[model samples]
Target: MKGFFFFLCFISFSAFCLAQQAYPAAAPLPKKNISIFGRGLYPGDDATYELLKKSGFKTLLLSSFYIHADGDLYSGDSHLPIIHNGKWVGDSAYVVRVKNLKKHSSISRIEILLEGRWYGQPPNTFDFIRDWYDPSKTVPGIVTGIGEQSTLFNICKVLKEVLGADAFCIDDESVYDSPSIIAMGKIAAKLNMHMTLCPFTKYSYWGDILRASDEKVVDALYLQCYDGGARNDIKDWVTALKPQQPIYPIFMVRGSFGTCDSYKGSKSVDEIRAQLKGFKSDYPAMSGASIWQMDDVKKFVSMGCAVKNPASGTATDVAQFLKQLKTTFKREL
Candidate 1:
């Protein structure tokens, strides 16, 4: 009897060890919060900015920081001034307009984007510094080149000093290595800037990026749900990404750009609510919803919220609608 009992105990212990080796412990749940991204590449005046600021989003990401061949970032045609070689340059009126937003807008943090439309051939906005992958290596987190690191650091400093932008959002399609991504994130954080990931692809080290930056300055991951990413299920994304920071699933508004036309924003409060309700059921921990462009906020509000008059005034209706949306999404972490 004693020999049989010992043999059974040994088998049980071995099984336990194997199970532990097979399945790692689950990661801690992500924080709950909301975020927004804006390319600032739209036509408009202060009224446009005013309307967007009024909408309820925690952080406003000013996007399209086009990087040139020489590791320089340009704002393209943003409403805010772009930092170029340590100096902020843009139209004086537009610069003042953006400064006013900083003064009056209720937004808490501002982030600069590192993705944009390609200018032409090599080293354009979209095709800049994409090659950080080394196929010879097994690890997917090592950045082979250090030049991209310097450029990222410079972008961080200029944005922070000139526009008070202490946050950054990277649509990093170039290199998915953990060592390099984590190192770059550390540099940005060291420079007093919060780093965020904009995951729009099925492949790429999304989870690895989160794990590496969990201990560092990575703040949030905004998963793309519009256009090509529209078919991506939120539950699957949450499982795959296992993000450390809050995850805000983003949607699209009707427009004629690249993939913007893929999904169209419509005027049905219940329909929109139903779609988001499904997301809530699947990802109760999600902070909130984000739109692609800045103008989309107003579009969603006007359509879903049913703005009575176009020219008369739409701010009040949009504000009320956004308030309801925010309340629905403020999930406990």
Candidate 2:
């Protein structure tokens, strides 16, 4: 009986050891959050979402929400109509996918990015705001577009209630009208939505908006460290903004448009690492970093960039880029 019992114990112990070896403990979750701009993700697929879900990004800034020349609001470069006059025109599938990402993934926060850049004409959104926003007029009490609702208010309402957005991101590259931005910020605040800045230049303009706004309204600053802002130093922005919220430096990746060369703010994994390290060294308090947009990430995967393993597709490419950001900002051992 004693010999039989010993034999059983030996077998059980060996099995336990093998089980431990086979299923190692999960790695500790990274301390800092990483953010990404979503240009292509509004209509993205399951495969892309799966990779993004596991990509260690916590914030998803849905990009390029534009207020057209006419008061309609649209998303993405194709200008997929989202709101018209005062009604939801966005596809239900887009809404479902975005909401699902928040529900099932590590992406806890989703911000509607209102981008205004001079492509050919003045940024239509900011120009619209400047023209339409009447500070002399009192903001409407009922936000539900019942009566006397500004187009901006209706847009905010959809972004908050229908889209389930956490915040509104301001990326005003041109048309730095302080009153328009400040007024819009106040409106967003009233809607109980936070506002974040994506500034590439005009420190005083951003500073003016920050100073005039409520402390709770503006929560984070995502400084562009690429393209026109390539010369931007993290420390300078930190000092200028005097931000109460975390400042994340946004990096443009090299795989944009299927080209590996660093141009127009795109950097390789190594360059990104070195830059991130330098930024961290300069400002250790930086909570996270951001990649510009998903369109480039997809382009990188699809256009046959130098990804060592193509079998994994977007997952492999995204992991390669995001791994560098996450590792650089990861907490000390």
The lDDT of each candidate is 0.56, 0.73
- C-alpha TM-score for every candidate: 0.68, 0.81
Which candidate tops lDDT? 2
Error of 1 at 224 (Å): 0.5
Error of 2 at 42 (Å): 2.6
Clashing pairs in 2: none
Provide the lowest-lDDT 10-residue window in model 1: 22-31
Residue pairs with colliding backbones in model 1 are 33-287, 140-177, 140-178, 141-177, 141-178, 141-179, 267-303
What residue runs in model 2 are displaced by over 4 Å at the alpha carbon?
A: 1-31, 135-148, 307-324, 331-333
Residue 124 miss distance in model 2 (angstroms): 0.5
lDDT of 2 by residue, 145-253 (tens): 2123667777887888787887788988878889778887767666767778889999899999888876566777899988889999999998887877778889887
